[model samples]
Target: MEHYLPSFHLKGKLAAVTGATRGIGKAIASAFAEAGADVLLISRTDSDLKEMKEELQQYGTNIYTVSGDVQHYDEIIEKIEQKKIESSIDIWVNNAGINIRSAAEDVTEEEWEQIISTNMKGAFFLTQYAARQMKEKGYGKIINISSVAGHVALRTGVVYAMTKAALIQMTKTLALEWGNHGIRINAIGPWYFPTTLTEKLLQDEEYVKDIVSRTPLRRIGKLPELAGTAVFLASEASDYITGQTIFVDGGMTIYGF
Candidate 1:
């Protein structure tokens, strides 16, 4: 039997995923490892990182864990240098983000700054650092974990929405500037998911119902469901795609109620 595939295999590749201690980021890192890439996991919690590393090791892929806040560029860069990963990072997933929900009028400057710093500033700087490495190597994949809030305003809050919107634009601009260098940049915008960040919302039956009613899929997305898209972007299957945002929102973006 002859099998012809697009070579989705990630053997010998290296992937770095931020906020990989749990939730969607963890799922993406696990998926990348299962697909054959050595994974570098990053998060702020050392204990969580250790546990996640232990769990991911069962996949038989090399795993490295770094504990640091992405908002601190120097620390993140130092950690990356310290790891001295054997292979050049083929995929960089900027999945670390924070959300502070407040009414537009009640949002404080500090709250706004925190949201922007974590979701936009940190993501930009991390991508800049990763893209530099990728540019030198002449090939790389950068996937920013954005949200449906990037496209449409959510009742979740204005500060969070603003940062997400900025991320989408940043993804596009970076893609345009770095595409010639063979560094592809794209974003995945997820809808409601039952992750640590959204656990509160999920507990609210009415809120959950409203979200489901609005979404064509009629259910919240699962963390693992995002893994395939992450792998696709990191693999040769998406070599031709760049400067785009894939909405993994189960048709929520297109649904108008």
Candidate 2:
């Protein structure tokens, strides 16, 4: 291993990733483990969490998991303390989120609250908690999984976009507020990826074509492709980078049409 491969050596690091039971979160968690970090998986379902923990255990990395909703701050805090990982989370990833699709006019107040509760409020409080621990330890990495929808609107509607945009700003603000304490906060804005949540959209040929046309790469991203960004952000490779949202969107954000 060369020094240039800083992201490849995360040994001795401990990471906690939310929504690690599936899709992008799962990929990121597995990648972090492969890069030599002990990983703690968090999600709402215990079965899924256990399954993922077992799967990741096959990689020979230490895996811990907890089941809880990110919406309740007290519950999250309690879970963290109960797990005895309160001050041990070196890389905290706020990857759990939800998207409700509807036209702006058809969007319900309930829907807006759901998205905000998980995507914005949950992320904010969790990051705040992690930042406090990191400040005391003199180091930490915080990665928020946003979306290109944060920078560009999609037919998915306003609430999803709003929460993601808020996440991007939250990352920037936390990065600035915690930088002096050696805490680096960054975000990853992904485009289309094959996941249970996006399976319906991927099935529509016309919609798929439209997305491909807009993306310079002419295809949706793979889960693994997004993992490297998480690894880099979590490791020493990105020590100098903070308050930035790296768009892993195949150039979708830069396209006007």
Candidate 3:
């Protein structure tokens, strides 16, 4: 058991996390650092990236920051590849995502483009860039941060759900193609966590009560709970697992009963 337990540790690994300055991304980045991995935090905001780099330095792991936006994957990855860290990215987490909650009928082309480009298109290409680096090393772990709204029917953002669903499918498809290259791709389908994106919704008492009522665990998810799942998926412990979406939804995905 002692021999097997060490596989869960991410010591000496280099991980790149996009949208890593806040919420789920920050949690996952910190978890990687705590597990002994040097993290390359990516965010559109330079200030947030600088601040996050400082905060995670307490873990005694080397922390680096890059100002990049998921929507502009080409520019971002090009810069990353030119840097010294790109050649050895053992883990990559696609944690940058956005949600614009508008009704299907009221959804504008602008909203559609923003959500699709950021959540799905950007994630896929970023995974490709990271996978190429991993392909050279012949081993890697990729985790896509999806949502339960993509799995079950939710009366939330329709366009946001579409992108998430696409991400789930993208994880499966790439896992099959890249398995031989030793690149394992998977996804995390989170329900409701207290992210900056969900702050307003969580503030609504009726919304909170309704969400709790539908969840089998009778609660929303915790940050650590979700981060733990990310850690597991990114670790060698999940070596044989790929192309699967782990729903960290407080049993809400199975709450139809």
> Alpha-carbon error at 42 in model 3, in Å?
0.7
For candidate 2, write residues 129-213 as lDDT tens digits: 8788788899999999999989886777789998999989988887888889999999999999999889999999999999999
- List residue ranges in candidate 3 displaced over 4 A: 1-6
Which residues of candidate 1, in runs, are more than 4 Å off? 1-4
Q: CA RMSD for every model?
A: 1.5, 1.8, 1.5
CA displacement after TM-score superposition, residue 87 of candidate 1 (Å): 1.7
Residue 58 local lDDT, model 1:
87
Q: Looking at candidate 3, what is the lDDT of residue 42?
A: 92
What is the C-alpha local distance difference test score of each model? 0.89, 0.89, 0.91
Q: Model 3: per-residue lDDT, tens digit, 160-245?
A: 98888998999999999999999999999999999899999999999999999999899999999999999999898999999999
> What ordering of candidates by TM-score runs from best to worst?
1, 3, 2
Instruction: Return the TM-score for each candidate structure.
Output: 0.97, 0.96, 0.96
Error of 2 at 241 (Å): 0.3
Residue 89's lDDT in candidate 3 = 89
Model 2: clashing residue pairs? Answer: none
Tens-place lDDT per residue, model 1, 1-257, is 88666878789898999999878998999999899989999999999999989988888989998889988967988988998877778899999988888878888989887888888888898888888889999999999999999898788787788788888899889888998999999999999877899988899999888999999989989878888999999999999999899999989999876
* lDDT assessment of candidate 2: 0.89
